[model samples]
Target: MEASKVIHAIYTDDDVLMSAVKTVKAEKYHIEDVFTPFPVHGLDKAMGLAPTRLAITAFLYGAVGLAVATVMMNYIMIQDWPQDIGGKPSFSFLENMPAFVPIMFELTVFFSAHLMVITFYMRSKIWPFKKAENPDPRTTDDHFLMEIAVHNNEESLTNLLKDTGAVEINIVNKDEDAH
Candidate 1:
């Protein structure tokens, strides 16, 4: 496949990058991606990205964990093997729910956290032994990179990026086979 041409606009500070993003968006330039050394607050909103649904997924995972804990405890402490403790020999899940509160809470947290991590990894296409997609290594340290598809108006895009305070601008040809 033929390589797609893209422009890389590098910024020194996150604040500058944020302002540039707003300017670029105002001018109707489609930004492909942005790479940052650290998380920048409000960057997603500036980039016109929809809010993440990870919180909903976490809530569902927590609910599943709670249900699993309830069922497991009911089966183990009530039906599978009942034990006498504190003179309470009744094999009832509700009666023993207070004793299982800590377990329920821990399991809920564990499931939500682990599953969220896995979901994020999968959604981001970040797996073990995967190579980095960053065009510039400086972005990992102190630079922020904003990638924009070249289209055919490279001159205007370059001028606009330069006016937006880009420290460095690079034109990159991305071949499918390069990955």
Candidate 2:
């Protein structure tokens, strides 16, 4: 409730870990999280993680950027800063829009890129000026870990994990030193 509550069981082999994940999922045991050094094929299906919608978000953000750029450019160059130096009509959207394209494209790319990066950081809880909380360093390198929080009893959970080919298991107290 107050902090991250998890117990990590590390596995050396990806094949063993994937099979264990499939078994736990089949048994309806809720896995808190799984970390792997490299991507494991079909692991997302086994973990029941739905496909991400980042592409949709990117498209929507890009559209918003485009609209904003178009509106701003139309108002500014057509109304406020009309230039008559090129011997062309000052307020013609069709004529001067070719000249306004660089600004529009720059604004679109800027807005979409900034917004998408912000969205990704917020969703993943990774941002500048914030420290990351990675449990096992080996899991970031060459190991895979599966975590489950056992509420009242742990005997059956431990038995199940052991039977599923967990190479090493340990209880991790997340709040012991975290402030």
Candidate 3:
């Protein structure tokens, strides 16, 4: 099985962390992980992460929700159980569409919010009662963490980590557990 070796370094400030990230990329070292308490702008560029596609998914889901709402309302209110809700006309779907607009709009909003939330949760691999993979509690609170796996130069890597202003460092034998 393939294994991942990690060096976890904690930094006190974001500036130091960003500088270290740039320096590491310049040196051609692969950075495996970074955890920050809050988002630091330009961090994704420094780490070379691709732009997320969640917004596109959200828009598609919204359109699906709107379409479902419009179709269901038309079938139920206009065809299945026709009612003389207003005195305009009874048998015409187009004539009665204005009255169903409120319901369609409401269902659109409802489905969009509910389905989008579920999609986000599933796409992110977050689920109810799932255990978190927080390695250190302080990583969520204040400290910024950088995890790098080196193929060689353990001594030089340690020296480079110190030069990057890492306050604490530890070797972590990351488990290669199957997802």
Winner by lDDT: 1
Q: What does candidate 2 score in Cα RMSD to the true structure?
A: 2.4
- After best superposition, candidate 2 residue 86: deviation in angstroms? 2.0
lDDT by residue for model 1 (41-76), tens: 999999999999998999999988988888899899
How would you encode candidate 3's per-residue C-alpha lDDT over 1-51 as one tens digit per residue? 556667888998999999999998898888987989999899999999889
By TM-score, who's the top model here? 1
The residue-level lDDT of candidate 2 at 15 comes to: 92
User: Residue 56 in candidate 2 has what lDDT?
Assistant: 76
Order of the predicted models by lDDT, top scorer first: 1, 3, 2
Q: How many residue pairs clash in each candidate?
A: 0, 0, 0
Q: Please, what is the TM-score per model?
A: 0.93, 0.86, 0.88
Model 2 lowest lDDT segment of ten: 1-10
Predictions in order: lDDT: 0.93, 0.82, 0.82
Q: Deviation in angstroms for 20 in model 3?
A: 1.4
In lDDT terms, how accurate is model 2? 0.82
lDDT of 2 by residue, 111-147 (tens): 7788888888899898778875667888888899998
lDDT of 2 at 171: 77
